[model samples]
Target: MVLAFLTTFLATRFVTHAIRSGRGPFRDASVGGVHVHHEVYGIFLLLGSGTAEFAYRPGGGWGSLLAVLFGAGAALTLDEFALWLHLEDVYWSREGRSSVDAVLIALVIGVLLLIGANPFDADRSAGEGVVALTLLVNLCAALVAILKGRVVLGVVGVFVPLVAVLAALRLARPTSPWARRRYPAGSRRAARSRQRFPPGRRNRWDALVDLFASVPHGTRPRTATPTEPDPEHTR
Candidate 1:
């Protein structure tokens, strides 16, 4: 299933980029007057695979086939994740980068699970209350990290509790909801956060993300306004 998802995602990205560049025979498909997006095909594939799996409860090779189909479908749907996220066609806009982030996050979690990382692996000897408490603590820590704008860390913390705890302990990004609401304006903590994560700062993750997709993805031009630098999303 993982292989199928990765293969389909790579192929879809290649074809879409080729079409955009007019570098190959790949072209956009349309039905009547409406242009069709690849997510449509993915949605159908998911429905068919899911329905077959549930109705027939197939095993062995059939089960594997369904899993592959489901994985491919997921990749397709998530490739346009930004479109559905904002209820608009932001596929080539700056916001569209979220689609890439979504795919990367999915890939990370899927691979982690495949490699035997389990978030629910509590000690059996521990009482149910202990297990429940641990789960709650982990959940709260992950939520805090997310609110602090450590999105990747928050997600990873679900699989690794320590990661979430550490992220929650760290200072929130200057633009994060947590910082905006909790840190008073002009406060020392707010100033420190802004200094730590200045606007337009780039990191290794930014380069890694750009490696998978084209830059400028048809981002809309900004209108004339204050010349202040734009804030960057801390991936």
Candidate 2:
């Protein structure tokens, strides 16, 4: 799965760059005068692979191949997730950054799965009750983190229960539900959270994202032009 994802991602990026730079004969795919996004193909692949897996209950080599297909589909779909969300050609806009974030998140989750890190780490000798209890506790922690809007942390924490617990206990992002409801405006807790995640910190994070994601030039939000006062009003 990891190999499939990386292969598709890199190949897509390379082709896109080559086309953009006029170094490749390849052009954007279109039909009936409408541009076709790769996500369409991705959706089909996912559906086909999922159906094949379910119908045949494929195992061994066939199962691995199906998994690869699914991963490839996931890569293509997530690469244009922001376009689906905005229902526009935001592929080269600031909104496109979401696609990069999604890819990174998917990669992290895939790595965790590959590592075989189980969330429910109870021993078989510990009995069924103990195993169930452990799973329940981890689930609750993961739920709390997710509810607090630490989605990435919550997802990754599923494989590391302690991380979920810590994230759940920590202050939520300033704009998250937990912060808005639990840390009221002007409250000390809110103020502290704001300090921790200041505007500057967000800007720095954005810089890192741009650096890693290789965001296209001119995609950043444009500054609004300042309007001059009317001559009559000024006089």
Over 4 Å off in model 1, which ranges?
122-125, 215-235
**lDDT for model 1:** 0.82
Global CA lDDT of candidate 2, please? Answer: 0.73
* Candidate 1 structure quality by residue, lDDT tens digits, 1-235: 7888888988988887765555678856756535577889999999999999999999999999999999999999999898889987777667888888898889888998999877787665377777778878998999999999998999999888899999999999999999999999989999999999999987876777676666435533333234322212101
lDDT of 2 at 49: 94
Which candidate gets the maximum TM-score versus the true structure? 1
**All-Cα superposition RMSD per candidate:** 7.1, 8.6
lDDT of 2 by residue, 1-235 (tens): 8889878876776665554444558666656545577888889889999999999988999999999999899888888878888887666557877876787778888898888876655564378788787778877888888877787788788778788889888877787788888988999999988988876565554664575356334322322224432211110
Give the whole-model CA lDDT for all candidates, comma-separated.
0.82, 0.73
Per-residue error for 53 in candidate 1, Å, reads 1.8
**Residue 228 CA error for candidate 1 (Å)?**
38
